[model samples]
Target: MHPQDSPSNRPTPVSADTREANRRQDHFGSREAIWLFGYGSLIWKADFAYRARRPALIEGYARRFWQGSHDHRGTPEAPGRVATLIHQPGSRCLGMAYLIGPEVLAPLDLREKNGYLRERVTLHFLDNDLADNDQPDVDDPLDDDGLTTARTAEGLVYIAGDANPAYLGDASDDSIAEQIAHAHGPSGPNSDYLLHLADALHAMGGEDDHVFGLATALRRRMRQAATHPATTD
Candidate 1:
């Protein structure tokens, strides 16, 4: 972690007005089924129940570990790094879209506390096999060649802005990896989160340079630490 990036520097609390605004924009009114985009820990550690899930792609955003975690992954003294979306034109993020019910909103809101706010975005599901089930209507037109074309739909995603106090902004990959290598919080070791995300992406045949790079660095650091234990005179 950066020297000034102390978790004690608590992030500005999410005001009620901001929460209301986010809810007003992303809330599903009376909609039985809602779609949610999951790119980071949500991919493998989705604590909420869902109806179905499909591989999805979202454009105009990039997954980055620029957010500080003070609860699930760290504490008030040493915050752990976590993923947050940053707008980058032409960039696409691959993840999963979950079909969930309306009841999930409350718990999700609490879980994504701190600087994270829910934002609506268009998600393209690659699978065209939703015919067996009642899939939500998509705005994108289908291809005539009978090849499976991506279907587009609006979904809610959690994002933390750079202005947020919890935002770590830019840091060297080695520095970030070093922090993650030794951080642990209420949830568990921060390295577990990185490894899980990397493994999940690999299993889906997806490659995220940032995520994979950090994971590799963290592994190397861990190996070094294990091979040469620190001495205390």
Candidate 2:
């Protein structure tokens, strides 16, 4: 179901006045803020032109590139694989923190529909003066508190899936690579997701070594395919 159709993500069925008030409150001002933690696609395709993307981390969630679903990502002919966050104890995953206007939530919610759910997480900007001072040049290391260590929010943010029976949390690198490469889009395969991510990370000059690690892995994988077409895909 679309995020708007999902009762959990929507405002309650209430009086018109109450609903209006709720909408007003949810409508964040230009400076009014919310933090979106991006680990996967959002890391690069954060369509929201954020006021500022601060380097911060939230604890408790470990990103596993395992989630598998035939409905949205895969097809009967060429099954695709994607990434989803998993609850892993005593562990941390690297990600980016986006402080954006509330207006962007609508599309973000919609993009993460069907199986995914949203849970709000409160992430601290490594620098309290978030926008002031020099923006960390791409790749500048900012400390992160994994899913367990960071503060959790009562409000909701979109999640990949919510207790989704179809959710599968583990997929092989080759599987993900093939899916990313083979993904059919009006313009191209979902491979652009990976390619853009590499480009974005490179553009941002991410100081985090982990992002570099994945970027390096993807580069090598793509190079391998280029060198030996028959072996790839």
Candidate 3:
């Protein structure tokens, strides 16, 4: 367990207004089910129960580790980095999508309370499989070329704004890896998050350059640490 895992290091409480804002902005009108796009920790540590899970792709965004984690992955003094989607034209992020019940809203909302805002996005499922029998069938939107587009569904994702206090903005891969390798919080070492995401992407026969590059640098740093243990006072 990491030092930040202590109860005292738990994340700050979510404001009532934030909760209400999420509820009000949710565009899942009268729908019995909701789709959620998971690009990072949700890939492996999705503690929340869900009905269906499938490979999905979202365009117009790139996964970046610019968000700072103060509770789950790090502390107030040295926050760990976490992945957040950044708007980038022509970029597509491959992730998983979950079909979940509405009751999950509150818990999900609180879990991502730190510097994250729930935003709606369109997900294109790679597989045609629909885990739920009652899920609605919607026509895929066509592009200008008149080609059949991937099956699409509207979903909510947690994204941190550049203006968020926890935002780290931009940094070199080595810099980010150094921070991740040394940071530990309630959840675990920050490097574990980066490596896990890279492994997940590899298993799916996909690649994310930014995540993989950081993971590579982090592994090298870990090797160095193992070879030269810190001296005791």
Candidate 4:
């Protein structure tokens, strides 16, 4: 559910008529702050002037290198595939949060459109501090909400169709490594994306030790596979 449309929250829905009338003003309205949870490429290239940004921890959702994409980080001509969140046990992934105003959603909507559906995700967003004129150089940090419960946040969940395969359950580490090696996007290979993610997580001080071993193994496997392809019996 959109923040404006939550059960406890009551925001006047922008009707077709209102939206049409407000089209011109949509870009001109005084922006209200909204928060976005960045997990993948968004960590690096989410475009929006933020009021505050801090390291955050989200629960009940585990990041998986599963869902594939054909856009955003990819193009039609030799398109690249990517991953998304899937339910799992004892999983915690590190990601960033952006305190953006409502005006930014319009662009984000277009960017995350197509096959991706917006779902309400429950994440513990650290009410991080911002650098206002008053709090300049105040050493912004992640705020401890001290509460880990279900909260609604608009998130795009990826679905497969455009040259994508169905969920193959929990793939073995080797299988996932193989996929990353083969997958390619507009920028580069799937392994490159994973490496970038690992780098970003490290940059944000995200806690997840699984990726370390996974990345290291993928590199060695990719190297050996390049020299000796398995003979299909």
TM-score per candidate, in order?
0.83, 0.59, 0.82, 0.60
Clashes (backbone N, CA, C under 3 Å), per candidate, total 0, 28, 2, 3
Ordered by lDDT, highest first, the candidates read 1, 3, 4, 2
Can you give the lDDT of residue 82 in candidate 1? 87
Model 4 segments beyond 4 Å from truth? 1-31, 72-81, 122-169, 225-233
lDDT of 3 by residue, 74-106 (tens): 777777889999999999999988877688888
What lDDT score is found at residue 87 in candidate 4?
54
List model 4 lDDT by residue over 1-233, tens digit each.
43223221221121212122223333324424445667766677656666555456566666665444334433333223344565556776567656555666666655554333334444455434431221322333322321111133433222222222322234555656665565565556667777777788787667655565557768889789879987987
Instruction: Output the lDDT of residue 167, model 2.
Output: 48
Whole-model alpha-carbon lDDT for candidate 4? 0.50
Question: Per the 3 Å backbone cut-off, how many clashing residue pairs does candidate 4 have?
Answer: 3
lDDT of 1 at 216: 92
Candidate achieving higher TM-score, 1 or 3: 1
lDDT of model 4, residue 153: 45
Task: Tell me the whole-model lDDT of each prediction, alpha carbons only.
Answer: 0.76, 0.49, 0.76, 0.50
